[model samples]
Target: MHIEQLKQKIVAALEDLKAQDLTILDVKAATSVTDYMIIASGTSSRQVMALARNVQSTAKELDVELLGMEGLDAGEWVLVDLGDILVHLMQPQIRELYDLEKLWGEFANPINHQA
Candidate 1:
């Protein structure tokens, strides 16, 4: 799938679970690791895990490889690696602490989305 289509699917998956603070950062020019960084917040650990799982399932349907998943046990911050897209599902508190959006925001234009 194209990057834009993949990003849409990811946003849909996150919205399916009612994820908050959804932000899509375009890091293509800033980094070679991934084209886009999707950051969202789930209310709790279970919700965080659920959000990640939803992304995984959706990605599978799209034929996107699930590179890896991290922080599932702790559920504080789960990172989903899909070849060109890196998803970060975190609790509101954790999101605030790390402020990943700002970190990556500095490097390039970060697209602030409201799904």
Candidate 2:
């Protein structure tokens, strides 16, 4: 499957798992680091790790080659990079500190969810 389709599948799965405050930013015009940025939160460190793990597993099942990650060791924040699509699974406190959603105002929408 195309990377964009794979990335969207991952996002939908995350939302199914209630990844809080999920935000999808179209960064194509903003930066070269990636085309899309997916920022999501978990209620706790453990849940954050679980959410990251789920993303990893889903990628594996879909046969998408995903970039390996770090921060799962700390369980505070985890990043799953699928090339053009980057996913951040973070704890509430960590997310608050980062404030990623606010950083990308252009991709704003009425998602109305907080994992």
Candidate 3:
């Protein structure tokens, strides 16, 4: 699937499930690991995990396979790798420390978005 398409799908799933501070970063020009990075926060651990799982399942329905999932135990943050779309579902604390938005803020050049 296209990176842009996957990014939109993940964003929609998170928004429908009420994830907050939705941020999508296009890293295709920056890194080879992935084409995009989706960072969002959920109020609690359960919510964060749920958002990750929902995203995973939805992507599957669309045939977007995950490379792997991490941080399902304490669930502070769940990283879902969708080849071109890397999702970061985090609680406030985890999100703060990682500061993904800050890291990508300077590089998030607005591009065509379907979502």
Candidate of highest lDDT: 1
Better of 1 and 2 by TM-score: 1
Candidate 3 matches the true fold with a TM-score of 0.88
Which residue runs does candidate 2 get wrong by more than 4 Å? Answer: 106-115
| Model 2: how far residue 61 lies from native, Å | 1.3
Estimate every model's Cα lDDT from 0 to 1. Answer: 0.92, 0.80, 0.83
Cα lDDT tens digits, model 3, 49-105, are: 899889989888899777899997778999998888888999999899989878876
Report the C-alpha lDDT of model 2 over 1-115, residue by residue, as the tens digit: 8866876788888877878878777777777887777888899888888888889888889887787677998889899888778888989888889888787766543233344
Compute the lDDT of residue 64 as modeled in candidate 3: 77
For model 1, give the RMSD to the true fold.
0.9
Candidate that beats the other on TM-score, 2 or 3, i.e. the better one: 3
Higher-scoring candidate on lDDT, 1 or 3: 1
lDDT order of candidates, best first?
A: 1, 3, 2
Pairs of residues clashing in candidate 3: none
TM-score of 2: 0.84
Cα RMSD (angstroms) for every candidate in the order listed: 0.9, 2.9, 2.2
